[model samples]
Target: MAPTLPFRDINVHASPSHYAFSSPSSPSSPTLVVDRPSGDLRLHDGKLLGTQRVSSIAGILGIIKLRLDKYIIVITKAQPMGRLKGHMIYKVIATEFLPLRERPLHDPDEDTYLSLIKTLLKTGPMYFSYSFDLTNSFQRQAESDTSAPLWKRTDDRFFWNRFVQTDLIDFRTGGGNAHGFRQSLGQQPGMDPYILPVMFGMLEIKNTSIKGKPLTFVLITRRSRHRAGTRYFSRGIDEYGHVSNFNETEQAIILNDDSSSGLGGFAGDLGYQNGKIGGAAAQERQVLSYVQTRGSVPVYWAEVNTLKYTPTLQIRGVESATQAAKLHFDEQIRLYGDNWLVNLVNQKGRERRVKEAYEQLVKSLVSAPTEDTEADRVTREKFHIVEPERQKHELDRLHYIYFDFHNETKGLRWHRAQLLMEQLREPILQHGYFRGVDPPAVATESKSGTDRRLW
Candidate 1:
């Protein structure tokens, strides 16, 4: 099924009874109404009734309750970031909160809560797409079930509006039956016209041509909502194994191939059949994506800030740290296969303690003998298999490399950085990037012994 484009230009009509939202471009489009009395959402026949004020909004973000009043968050201004897979992406440039009640209660706590919300929205980076799932990478989207709606397919870790959009999601699933509404407005239950999922992170897209072949380079960094806070206030892994400031960055290249263009050289030699764009028989677009992630050390640790230039680092709970690291690596392996942990910290200094702790933690997981003692055996078995053979397998998959970046790069000797790259060359080659194309063409190229190496 084709994805439905969300309404970009929405006309919001505020009345004494309810607030009506309708698309200004489409007169026949169904209008979503939110009753002020009970805060119930229902569908209208694209007709404005008792409209006191009319305003144009980019899109509805969601609804949030601040003490005694509920406010509707709307995107006041948005700028186009770029397009991915033929879907236009937008970054929220500005936002406004419209109170549901005409005269909201003036509570001190409510004011504080509203101020916090405003500060968060103002400071945080948010991006969204009408039809594309911004929370997921291109490779993930290609593997996901396309039949699902964009809202449902979004990654929960980056879904910034998940908490506020609960009502809309519930309304979609309930089919508006409780409010005596039955019409779907020609949209599936999974797709809601009034619902927009926002992702919190960075998105950059550059359109350029290589050898006269047009292509788009996109960089997307998605931040996890879990354990997220200020640098000093939030550090280390939580009991649930969620690390602070966890983020996944994906670099993707999108190429639209056309046979008529007669593009030759770099673009023409992509190993497609007959040296053609897609294949000799079929012309198609190509997308290549590579994803990497960063997070705080998955251990029980903290850095206390005491109004000093450098904070005091403390490593806590060795037993709990082991358990947390295990959970963290397990999840990483499940998502991205083998993990190459490259730790770059000072070898001797305040940061030395952290580096040593991390190294010891890794050694314990990958080398410690299972028959040390009953307590030791029990602790290892509690987290996962820690037998010698199992530990050996884990050691092979989980590689640890520590490099003193500051010491090596001293005096602007950047050439020394190549030493680190040499160590990572093997693992990088083993785990190739994700590229979407015909399987038969790829197999044919492989059989022909062609060298299609990527750097």
Candidate 2:
């Protein structure tokens, strides 16, 4: 079923451009100031106030957590739009806010209001910015929590401004520039916000009790941010040839209440010390990870190079297409491992040949690496073609994903059918190289479910 999102569903929207920040004049009068084109923002309060030069366009978005108290969220960068190499360019954006109260009550409506405010801001010409995250203080506090890994702060690459200072904003009246508006107001450090892709909406879930087991159906929709724009108006292919509006809708089912375990340590750690000693400990925490990916498979094609809305599938050559497809699956195998399911959305009889080619390609690529003979065999054995008859049961595991490339529903913003094709792909966060390290040795889990040495 198409999942319905809550009012707080996280979707990316262009932020408002007009709002700016200024020093607070009085206890009652707060002022807003816009930065000039010269990229200068001054802190006006005393004690090193008017000292720092903030070379970014930013402004206050609004006050959140209003039910408990008002916390002002400020966008530090003003007007994210700028030009690069004579072509319009957009980069990541930064944001920081000060909380008013020492301890504000947790308001559930905060997410909903935040989404609404961002949506309203998108009505104007605002693009060319990546994401906004709170400054350093909140990040330290967020990373301090061990119980909630999901809430833990990730690496700085994901943050637009990872090096922002504490005294960037000069707070008047309440306290010095180093502290927030008031030092006694019980202000906490900042936490970076997860800039959910504009393609996906807020988190949604359904609860049910099947037999005696508690079950949860969670749906996460991921839309591609690359070259994503209005219907027909924006080009479908990016400069790098990646397609636009490729959405990956993930449906995950949990048999019980358990947090998803993660690989401990930094982002690009190969089989590092996760506190657990052997493969058995890791296997014990596996938690039935059954996932499927259905999206525009890696095919060497582009649409933006031509004037037509849906440019012809510019297949460079048969060999190039195969190479692209191979690179795509190579990354997938590394990230998801060999066991996850693959469903290439069959497009009538037109894609039959492509499907056959892809199937053969996966088989050839999966088994080809003679450098690691045992690993190659294991990879080949792990991936198997799903039989048509049991396709439903194969999908009816702890996770189920349905991918549809409905040409009718998605009219050809490209073709005669004004239909737009959305491919349900895995999050790009899943696929990143663990740089400066050799491929770690494979550790096979034992059938006895005991500890097996990973490295």
Candidate 3:
């Protein structure tokens, strides 16, 4: 079946954009600011847009337990979570076992799978999941929406001036058979508001290395920020790698000396002016030899083998659904467009149709309804979001990932996890970018999934 989502599920508190830091904490629950705009925490009005029941204990517990296994945790079916002026959100109850490898639960309209993978790796073996939130993320409907990048945190503690803090509830794993999901942060559950399942879902990948097991599926979630000129893009090195190669010759260096004064040690007066070197000094004279060297792998080249693509687009100048369709067709222009204004000259069965629809949609924007945007809609665009800011993006909630074994070491295996996390992060977090300020980078690397050859 085609993938679907419901956005209304998570806004239980529907808290305002700003929440104070001083608040009380429940027994096991995390802490939060008590002085919110309103008293309701669901963050939503008393309106149940739709209701469906999940017929499994795991599904019910998935919402509360962190260590629930992949098999036991069940989630409600995807549904429309919420909707604002420019976009819509879908929600799910949370599930344990996911769809088959062939059937991925990714954003059908965009490439969000890899971003989620990277988030999981960074907090690999997370003690347990923490309170989830999406305010601090660089969000967008698509990956290439490079409007306003939020990763440039004024301070590491704050993403967009929201001083967020979380209580680690303990990360849980479904324990395959007996593994049991029970992981926590350094000493206790992390008290950072941005660390949660969604954080794992928002990695903007650069590259990944696998091990004995092959990662087969790439799952990603959607984001909340979408604005005009959003230049969204994401990449993972399938063939090329970001890691620099090691130098066979430029190994560690050690200093040695043979000629010393009489006492070798610090002496006074005319000390050791005529003496020879000591046994230690003689030993130092022995030429330095290579102990070992880490090999080099061409990052650009490695990217080729593991190459993957995430769709990118902008939401500007689009009035009607037809315009949206044309923008979709125009993705090729964003990817392959090389000359200036030449993209305007494209023609084909699909391209022609999409362009036609987009032109029609542009006409509708003239008389669209009016709704005051909360903040400067133009400024809320997301692009090139940084490492931490991406954690709060709604799209970073992927839990099920498969790693295809293609000759990767355990360290490299862990690297794959990291790659999956970073790649899921939004690129160029600006809304204007989606409006075609820049073309998304093309897939230049290979996808052979081989050990990167070091230079």
Candidate 4:
């Protein structure tokens, strides 16, 4: 696979009929053209005549359609956040929307939709990288196929622009008249250089030394787009088991044994292929990553706002709560083995109901019977007789813990958190974490394989 060279500085030109995006650094690169009448996107080799330069942008984010017309979103400004394994990550600081229509639409609802899109872009935190796959963790990237494009391998849950980038992706995949366009433009069949994937999350990088060794600590939190909303507006699990406000937080530490190594040596290495370093140059760096998730309780409950200090708490769908909880836990177990569900709600008052409901739902799942046939039951009986301990351990997977945060941390005694730690210390220690080293031979293997490797 050829190396990916992202377009860094793009010049935007607007003609009366279309808009053209071209890179000033690489003049030979194909220009992205968007027709004004139909909002169709294509590649152009020659510049559009009689066009005026509109703005300089970092990259094209994607295109979104309002009630009246389609508008292309572009990154007007971006700032470097940090680097991971030589890949420079950037955060979208400002953005601008260019309407595909030459004239403005007078529809009333179009303004509201446009305002909503602007609000989301302004408030949401978005980050992207030219070479790095920001939607996936280090472990996932190490195991994934390296030959594929970055956009194809992105996790849909964190790909914030996935829906809006459908046209571009389809064009690249030969969905419509892309074949003729690619043939005319002489573009390759691999990843499209202009199709950029943006992730909505929080990222922080700190450079410091630990015991005379160079260390880089990074914290990234990715919010799930499924059933996402502000608190008090969205709550509980849906029919598909998606919870509100779900987020994955990852803390990564990159340590280098060679103190003489500079940041320039780490740039553009692409180091996570098959759990091995990119080349001999990056063999001294060691990476360790740990991920944890937080979400609303995966049960049928909601807080209804009634213009009061406290909203009314309601728990519905009691009959289907068990199935929903099962779906949620099953997926969790499949992704991260042996879930350690820590409930941090009050044990009394209105919160007590939620706490009890959660406990009961977990208990039912643990005690539920399996739909086994006669032959399957006989085989299980024999296997259990031979390996009872292993069978029991496999059968009982979920562990639940309840702690009253408000009651324990009352009177400014925040040290009471030690109690919760004491209860979870054993399980956490046993669960362990993920570490990636330079050589594939010396890397620590995950005991549970892919299941324990957090995304």
The model with the greater TM-score, 3 or 4, is 4
Best by lDDT: 4
Cα displacement (angstroms), candidate 4, residue 50, comes to: 3.8
Candidate 3 clashes: the total is: 158
**CA shift of 445, model 1, Å:** 20
Q: lDDT tens string, model 1, 1-455?
A: 55545677888888878888888687776788888855678777758767865689888889887777889899999988877755778988888998877664477888899899998998888999887888986656655655566687888888888888876776777644234455343333523666788999899988887777668888999999888988887888887778899998888786764323331112223446654445552434566778888888777788888989888888885666887778777777766777767677676778777776776676677754342111122122111112233545554356666666676667898987786777668767777676664232222221111111111
TM-score leaderboard ranking: 4, 1, 2, 3
Reference-based TM-score, model 2 = 0.36
lDDT of 4 by residue, 269-380 (tens): 3355676644454555666777777788888889999989888999885667777777777777766677766777776678877876776666566644232111132122
> Candidate 2 lDDT, tens digit per residue, 1-455?
21111111111111122223333222222223222221122222322223333323233333344444444454444342332111122322444444444444555686566556456444422222122111111112222332332222322212222122122222111233321233432322111111111212223445565675445554434344444445433422333534434443434443332223221211122223564322322222221112233334344434334675554443333345555544444443443443233433453444444444444433444432121111122122211242222223211111112122343224443342221111112322333211211122322321211111000
Query: Which sequence of candidate numbers ranks them by lDDT, best first?
Result: 4, 1, 2, 3
Total clashes in model 1, counting residue pairs 3 or more apart in sequence or in different chains:
0
Best by TM-score: 4
Error of 2 at 213 (Å): 9.8
| Clash numbers, per candidate | 0, 27, 158, 0
The alpha-carbon deviation from the true structure for residue 155 of candidate 4, after best TM-score superposition, in angstroms, is 1.6
